[model samples]
Target: MKKVLIVGGVAGGASTATRLRRLNENLEIVLLEKGQHVSFANCGLPYHISGVIENRESLLVQTPEKLKKRFNIDVRINSEVISVDSSNKKVVIRNNGEEYTETFDYLVLAPGAKPLVPPIEGIHGNNIYTLRNVTDLDKIMEKLKEKSIKDAIVIGGGFIGIEAAENLQEKGVNTTIIEAAPSILVPFDSEISNLLEVELMSNGVNLLTNNKVIKFEEKNERVVISLENGNKVEGDMVILAIGVTPDTNFLKNSGINLGERGHILVNDSLETNIKDIYALGDAILVKHFVTGQDVSIALAGPANRQGRIVADNIMKKGKTYKGSFGTSVIKVFSLTGASTGLNERSIKVLGKKYEKMYLHPNDHANYYPGATPISIKLLYEKESKKVLGAQAVGVKGADKFIDVIATVLKFRGTIEDLSELDLAYAPPYSSAKSPVNMSGFIGENIEDNLVEQIFVENLKDFDKDKNIILDVREEFEVVVGQFEHSINIPLGQLRERYNELPKDKEIWAYCAVGLRGYIAYRFLTSLGYKVKNIAGGFKSKLKI
Candidate 1:
């Protein structure tokens, strides 16, 4: 039997080991983890801070003894792989203050990633913490138990940062998020992430965007963070949820190809530069599904899938991993935001000619109790009409639409494919024309030249002299808000008021949430007047 040595144990390593055993029970497998626990739910670590996941023991999904009994594989905790000797197929591991050598016929490196704690002044203070595993969660939980632990400063506004802030608020701590980027949740466009920001502010989580922490000082037993703008924030505890880096330091001199950021570069078969050596998980570079560029997605779903593919390749089954779309979702206090594939920022960087459409539709039938509007944005190639990506935000069902779009992205489907999907529908669950279908209908309108729409970002560049901003929403809706210098011509009265509008100047129309503006666009276009509907309308324009 060929001995296989696997380093690390989590979504990637743990799944690969179990699948390998199931595929071929004759192989000898050894799993090594630097940490004490194996296969723990790292994603649920933030929830435990608020007692949302009350039982701490539940996070540990597997044990060494269990894996030994089930798969007859050797499991070693507290065993850290310090270096790889690929020429001899041996690894140097440090455990219990001792080092040992392990030989393998096939070596797999799945050492995931570590929290990136930047070097800032006073960062090593006891109150500053970075959560990556159960050990990190324990340290944070201990800090939260202090009676005077009232304020927490989360240093980033990515997924982990926002999740930590929401959970910290739930634990009765006044949480503040400090983001260096212009907006939080950079994966979603500003329009979608703005909804999450609103939810966070409404729940008393302070957000500081376009700011960076220059230094950290310990003052009065609290962490004092000095910002680039000369503002100072004091918090009983600080969480450095900035990001993560690939944990491949051990393989730096191992003759295996590594990316500039230290990510293991593997072929589609997941094999490294050296023969019989493989790498997977968050520590490896993967091709992006949309752009086809090597990128670091660092998502658990893709890691788990890559593990299975790597296992099959090792078994000579020859499976290939296409790529990752970076599909992910986040829960704020009361709202959820989800996205898949590329966003506008990325598309522009690639210089791809793309079109975006937005729709604000009720998640379910309006007559159904508790129905709420969901903002959906879809991006597609202008000529091919191929669905590039999608984002959704709402009190509920945001993940559903993104999941559908992600599946479509996997198959490289088009906007028309989204509209034709036979989705299940019930009054309380979804409308007859689901939000996903609505996006497809809107896309068809754009493709057929039945409608021309402009996004909220385009308003600043519109020529005020030659363009008229028309508000087609009902008169009462203006109380919420309207564009400056925009004239009110409700969709109902657009026909009668047509003579009042200029035929030479372009009409830029808007409504509360775009449906009425779309109607106005169609009515005005038929009369041979140049018109453009404000995509997503006034609602999307608010608070941005």
Candidate 2:
């Protein structure tokens, strides 16, 4: 019988082991885990701190004994793979201070990633913690119970850090998130991400952007974070949720090709450079589904799928993983943010000729109670008209919008395909024209040259003397705010006052959102006036 030895018993390793057993009952599968728990919901770790996930046992997806009986696979916890001898197809493992060698016909490495704890002064304080697994969660839980966590500081603004801060605040603890970037949730473009930032601040979560911690020191029984800008913040506890690095140090001399950041280099089959060796999960480099560039996306969805693919190839079933789309969604307090494919910043960096448009639509029907606005941004290749990426932010419907785009990306579909998708609709669930459909319609218009649009970021490029900024919103709405040097002309009064507007200069029109502005754009264009709707209108301008 063929034997498969797997290292790391989380999403990728656990899936591979059970899958191997399912494919062939006679196969020998040995799964080694460095941690005590073989498989647990690492994503639910933060929710546990907030008591949202009250039952700790519920997080453990499977136990070693359970796997042994159900899948007939040998599961060993606390057995750390110390080194890999790829040439000999063997691994050195340490368990309870005892070393042993495990030889296998096939070896799968799925050692995921470890929390990146920077080497800074006083970082080793007892109150400083990094959550990665059940062990890490246990320590944090114990600290919460053992001490009074009055104020907490999260030293990152990514998914884990944001989630941790939200949960901490739910526990009635004052939480502050310190991020080095200009904004949080880097996956979403700045305008969309800013909406989330506003939500965080409104919910009593202190957020500090464009800041980094220089050092840590314990003062008055609290951790003092000294910022690089010479500011100090005191907190009872500090979470080092900065980021993660591939946990591939043991394979340094194992002859496996690794990326610059130590991510294992693997082919489409999940096969490493070494013969009979495979790698999957966050520790491996994968091609970007849209960009076709080698990148590292530490997402659970792709890792889970990659696990099944690796098992299929091991059984000689022939499966190929084209790439990962980096599709992700996060709930930050009341607002949710989601994105898939490339953002505008990335498109610019790649020097791709792209066109983008933005829209503000209700998550559901305006007639329905409790309707909230969703900010949607779509990016596509100008030449191919192919949908490159999209982002959505709102109280709800973010996941739905991004999921649709992610599916379209999988089929390499174009913007027109999005418009033609017959999505289900109900007053409480979605608008008559779903946000997805609205985005498609808008894209189709741009593609067909029905109307031209300009973004607020490039408003300065329009010469003041040569271009007229027209606000199509009602006078009452303009009381709240209006763009600088913009003229107000309500859509209802545009027909009677069309002649009053300048016919020589270009007309840049906007409203509360894009619908009215779009209407004005078409009405003016028919009368032979140069007109362009500012994307997303005043709502998007507010975010910037």
Q: After superposition, how far is residue 374 of candidate 2 from its true place, in Å?
A: 1.1
User: What TM-score should be assigned to candidate 1?
Assistant: 0.98
Query: Residue 519: error of model 2 in Å?
Result: 1.1
Model 1 ranges off by over 4 Å? 462-464, 542-544
Clash pairs for candidate 1: none
How would you encode candidate 1's per-residue C-alpha lDDT over 1-544 as one tens digit per residue?
A: 8998999998999999999999998999999999999789999999999999999999998999999999888999999999999999899999999999999999989999999988877778869999899999999999898899999999999999999999999999999999999899989988788889989999999999999889999988998999999999999999999999999999988999999999999988989999999999999998998889999988889888888987898899989999898999999988889999999899999999999988889889999999998888899999899999999999889999899999999999998998999999999999999888888888999999888988787888778779999999889989887898799988899899888888899999999888899899888888988999999899878455
Q: After superposition, how far is residue 240 of candidate 1 from its true place, in Å?
A: 0.6
Report the lDDT tens digits of candidate 2 across residue range 328-408.
999988888999999999999999999998888888999999999888889999999899999998888989999999999
